[model samples]
Target: MTTQGQRDPQPAGRRPDGRSERARRATRTLPAKALGWCVVVAVVAGGGWVVSRPHPGDWIPGLGPSSADATKTPPVVGNPLPPTDTDPEALTADRYFPAQRTIEMGGYKGKRNGARQGQDCAETLRARDVDPLHDTGCQGYVTVSFSGIDHPALLSSVTVLRFADDASAAKAAQALRAQENAAAALAFILPDTTAAPAPTAGAQQPRVEAVGHYLTVTASRLTETHSASPTAGASSPGVTAGASTAGQSAEQQIEAATRAVSYAAGAQFIWT
Candidate 1:
């Protein structure tokens, strides 16, 4: 199959055309390159592992929270709340009673006798009145007096005791009502007389009401020295349900007015 002059068709690593197959190295190059590549991969993987883990903050002087600090409970996150006994200026008299010299409420025009606002509970009310809420978070006290513009003889008063919350006021109100048929009322702050006259109430009892965190004690009476008398004249519809004022005496008229004033006082506390 061979001719003497023509060499064998292929040499050890040559193609049939007599070109050397590929240049060969004295050492095994592929294995050495694979070993170098494996070494490089190992180094990169080791470096990445070291960088991925978190280092203790103690490793640096002032970098982040220490391990001990991180484990500790964080301080409360929201704003601090005020104490229950702190005064809320919202309960002041000028805002609640009337801004003007005179005000109309519940179809009755009234002239403000005066308002005693932000007075200490001890100062405005007697000891017995204040005792119910002394330890119960009574933070505000106000008393306002109003005389009828048309009927000067008629007078009305609203005494509001503001507590921290509805529960406190309700508790205090219950305590107050438990003692007497009507909550005791503060003396009128007369426009002219610093020396208040004696309680003018005859048959008309004060109204005690609690709305939210406020307690209002309302009363009405004749400004003049008068007591319950027999009806002087005849007939007209009265404000009280099923009760006709047609033959009502002066005392009975004032008692009806007390109901109106108490209702008006309740409205004042709706928003405040």
Candidate 2:
């Protein structure tokens, strides 16, 4: 028998406060374990997000004018040509004009003499023909003008020949020999003749252009002018004369001419 204010006895496996002690302990522990698991998952997820983010300075390097970026750039086009000078009297003549009266050999063709005799020999052949422009069988001419800057004549011209055959060309050359001055007869052999392709519409033959302060030589024209120089009459100007940038001797020019003539001749032969 208990007093009215006293508590009753607990049942087996049950807590005095209605819940079992074990159950209560378990309820409290479940929340703590869930919270721990949630914290661990959050930490893992946060680490993965940081790793997936891009690191600093991962962008492409700047290429400036060469950049291919399209969004921030405009399409590039070639620069416009500058206005030409219109003054008539301002036109300057080539300084090295009245070329040293020398003959230069260039083109493709075999010769009776050695390559060294080809240029002068070709000149001789041309001089003999009374009608060099009309009847001569030779294909072309090369004019050389002396350049004080380089103790050498600037080659200015290379005329192509349109002869029917080797015999006709030889005859024209023979005639030239009779007409050229002895002193002007120096040979310059060119490289082996290279075959020329048939000219297509709007296509021209490839040619060489040599330019200097006082001279300019092309396949068609060799001009010498008295162009002003930075160094006046300073005879011993530091700039090397008669030596190619490749350190080739002056005679190399003759060799080159020989080979060129040979190559041209071979081409003509093939075309014909």
Candidate 3:
């Protein structure tokens, strides 16, 4: 007979606790095994959370504005005057501008001969280290100025130059692009032009475009401005100047004028 305090007899290959040795070992490690699995799950969940965190100024994770973008000027909006066609030779001062309250003296003029064209544009071309006539192969040009304008500043000019051939036009275009790129690389706070002027104050960001054998430039002087490069300058006679930038900034006006003039010149070529 067993005593009252004595345990039951063990089976073959069993522990003193009446369980198999393997079963006892497994039971003893259950809590540790469960804890290890919980740690693994938590680690995976934490890694996912870190990966999904939102970035600044952007919705996506791990993507944000670079230092360059932070320092760069915001994009500008250009003027809205519908681009109109003007005869390359007959272009007038009035046709080249955005129709301001009054005209500036000697602001609008045109040249037909290559020699005269070079002389007149010599100063401007020299500023960029480019020969107006020789480097550009420019045959003729019409110019509109904003001198003596009554506003925040004198800004608003257009120059339409015709080349002898398409080859000349293409070369001018390439040269202009190179100049603009160089100016940008220098980090100058001037207008975007085919080339930056020697003086930053009088310099402007002009929209230079080549369509057919004609190269057109549109520019606006700013009172201290900011703007984006226009993708396309859209204009219509029905679209009033006021509508273009009712609440816009000076930078916007400059951009609009730049693009509008290019579009107008290009359109005129097609129609005329």
Among these predicted structures, which one has the highest lDDT? 1
TM-score of each: 0.53, 0.26, 0.39
What lDDT does the true structure give each of the candidates? 0.59, 0.32, 0.46
Q: Which is the leading candidate under TM-score? A: 1
Model 2 accuracy (lDDT, Cα): 0.32
For residues 13-56, what per-residue lDDT tens digits would candidate 3 score against the true structure?
Answer: 89765689888889899999999999999999998887776554
lDDT of 1 by residue, 1-272 (tens): 87788765565786565456464452358889999999999999998776665433333433544667455312211111222444444555545554343556554566656566553564455435445556767766777777666565567777777777889888877776775434343454554314255463344567878898888887776543333223222223332221222455666667666777777778877875
Better of 1 and 2 by TM-score: 1
> Candidate 2 lDDT, tens digit per residue, 115-186?
111212244222333343245433333332122223223221232232435556555445434533411222
Local error of candidate 1 at residue 109 (angstroms)? 3.0
Query: RMSD, each candidate, Å?
Result: 22.5, 23.2, 19.4
lDDT score for residue 143 of model 1: 71
